[model samples]
Target: MQRNTYGQSPPLHHPVPQHVSTVPQLRSPPPPPGSAQSQQQGYAPTGQQGNPYQQQGGTSGNVFGAYGQFMNDPTAQVAAQFGQTAFKQGQEYVEQNIGRYVNVAALKHYFNVSNSYVINKLFLVLFPWRHKGWSRKQAVGANGQEGWYLSPRDDINSPDMYIPVMGLVTYVLLSTLIAGLKGAFNPELLGVTATTGLSVVIVEIIALKLGCYLLSISSQSQLFDLIAYSGYKFVGIIVTITVAEILNGGKGTGGWIGWAVFAYTFSANALFLLRSLKYVLLPETNGQPSGPMQTDSRAKRNQRTQFLFFYSYIVQLFFMWVLTRA
Candidate 1:
């Protein structure tokens, strides 16, 4: 080796040979089995390499393995059972107590009317001049006691809330349409119209109930019966408004033609109530007792009859007119 001027020895340079072999040398042999060096060198045993995942412990494998471990754990199984029990208990509690807040039976009865009954009821309400029988039929129980009033499907005279509910909805939609045609439409108008209609029905029902109490009219009439009867006036109001709209060529203004139709409908509604309510206000007895008691009863019955007539004609006409105007 020769030293440079900087006092650093020159690097050694090996001489090149002309005949160098091209075949590669063999790699080192793999480490023995079960040794750390074999694992580090990626030398897994033959049978062990068949399923590397099976060698994993705890939850260190794939999703299925982790899930299987969770399912097999005793604490996890107990937690799942507790959760299922809690859910079943909650469902049972709701089912048991749900009826307290709602009258499911009465609701079912009111909405049990059939389509044919609705059509006939509508016709009778509009043209009640020829309908003679007005008493609601009764269903006798196995013990021969009157169980309940016949449903509207079984008796034409039986009252139902189905027609009233549908009629109220139809009236609201139609009134909204008319308002739009008259250039008076607004988003609030629909709710206002519905509120007005409901308020009128509520007022009418209260008045009828008060009259029944004042006249000592003790019949089997339920609150829904009064509601059903009171709500029928909407049918007449609907007809009046429809006629007015037709006459005005959809201008939404009711002229004399509307008033004429209103009058006819008012009369028909009055007559209908006059006949129909007699069954409720003055129920027939098996036989009349001939004495001073009979006279007093007759007087009371007469008073009830007069009040029913006043309500049928005067009350109905006012309410019907109000609805048409609304």
Candidate 2:
């Protein structure tokens, strides 16, 4: 049974398609240039589109270029030159002015000794009788000074402070050792002994100077010369003590045997000084004088000889005894 109306048929229905098209769709066009939408879409502004790594490298290159320019600047070069000039001037000033306080040349000359010189000097101090030459060797300086004493290495008779200073230290150490063996050692005992020894030397020098002044003995020797001669007694003192200690079975106190040894040493040291110091106290003369002035010079020379004998015998004996007690 079909019932069809004149104006209306049954409404026809169509199902929607379930499958999508396989063809690629076109994307929306990029937003207009210079618009906020372009920026929001991660597009760089005009004239700024480049690699990020290239921009970073350019920044580093600019920094290095600036540093190079600064280093090559005229002001930096001037500063470097100024620093060098100041250092050079300071060194020159020190060299020029330092001589006022210290005689650097003389110090160097005094210390310019060799191993052979030291060994020979020690042997000479211990056994001075064998050496015949007592006068220091002389040299002619560049300035035509004829009496310049040779260095210790060249002249065995040349005086030096090195041996004296070393002997002083050894004396102090030996005194300490002796004190320890006697069970009387203290830390302060070393200082006391050193002070005593130095005091004795100073007193002896003062006495000798006074004697020279009173006797009108005009010697060309420097103060260090006298000190060097005076310090030689330490060698004899050290030998005497060592022998005494050995004979007495390590005892510091000496007996009759020690006295005998000391006497021999004392006589030997006196003779050594008598021979060595004659050149200093009495200068050699080529001709003898004949007048009142000659007589006066002769008298003064005799007085100086007596003073030397007194110093060599009496002064040395007293000081040597004092050191042995220390």
Candidate 3:
């Protein structure tokens, strides 16, 4: 054996043999399973053809195993049951209180109201003084039956909600139009006006209901009747705004004509309400004996009714002022 300068041993030389290829042979590892080349080459991982989840049965074998069990477990069903129970409870609560807030029968009756009745009530709500008697007779239907439905008759029997509702919507639309013409249009104004008006009406209704309860006259009137009466102010508002809009021609505030129309409508509405609400506010003074006890009771009732009626007019005035100025 011979050693080089680095002290490494050198092997003895052997005779060289000629080969066809001189390049060194190299081998590459196989491509990963599911790769494009492996898939095309028909190479697949073991158990690849079986159910992926079943292949790895144990929780430790698959990452999604716990998640799958959690989804399929009764815990989810229990949660769903709880959610459904809560929803049902909420629905029942709403159903129970729905009538307290809004009378569905009144809404249906209003929807079926006659156009002529609506027109007549429009005038009647504005000019209720012309008809001295507030007692309204049930309108006879085509079948000759006295229908208990609401009409434009001069009474507090059935309050028509249609005119008030339609009048409110009309007021908003006309107000929006006027705003646009004056170059002061705003989308938010519509919502604000509507919500404000509705809030005012609802507050008035609640106040009137409370007042009636305090006066021991709640039994004499219905909730919908108070709502109807409170809503009637919108008719006069519609007229005043419309007339003001036309007369002012979308100018700065309203001129004499606008003020004039507003004043007229205001007085008309006050008179109408005064006459129309007297029956509801006051007890039956007619067709009854007028003794000392009766007279005293009648006098007290009249005083209260007159006071409330005047307060109602003041409220109407305030609401009208807000709506028109808004």
Q: Clashes per prediction?
A: 0, 0, 0
Q: Candidate 1: deviation at residue 70, Å?
A: 25
Candidate 2 C-alpha error for residue 125, in Å: 1.7
lDDT (tens digit, per residue) of candidate 3 on 1-326: 77899999987798877765678878676479768876554444776745454333322344466668877899887998999999999987886789687665446664556666677677677776666556656657798766553443344335777778888888788888878888889999899888888888888777777776666663323666667777878888888887776677756337888778878787787777676666565545353221112224766786767666765678777877777777
lDDT tens per residue, model 2, 123-157: 88777899998867778768865556788889888
For model 3, name the residue pairs that clash: none
lDDT of 1 by residue, 229-275 (tens): 88888888888888878987875536778778899999999998888
Identify the superior model by TM-score, candidate 1 or candidate 3. 1
Sorted by TM-score (best first), the order is 1, 2, 3
Model 2 stretches astray by more than 4 angstroms = 1-104, 141-145, 285-296
Worst 10 residues of 3 by lDDT: 287-296
Using lDDT as the measure, name the better of candidate 1 and candidate 2: 1
Q: Report the Cα lDDT for residue 107, model 2.
A: 65
- lDDT winner among the candidates? 1
lDDT agreement of model 3 with the native: 0.68
TM-score on alpha carbons, each prediction = 0.66, 0.64, 0.59
Model 1, stretches more than 4 Å misplaced? 1-102, 143-146, 251-253, 287-296
* Per-model RMSD to reference: 13.9, 17.7, 13.2
Best by TM-score: 1
lDDT of each: 0.79, 0.76, 0.68
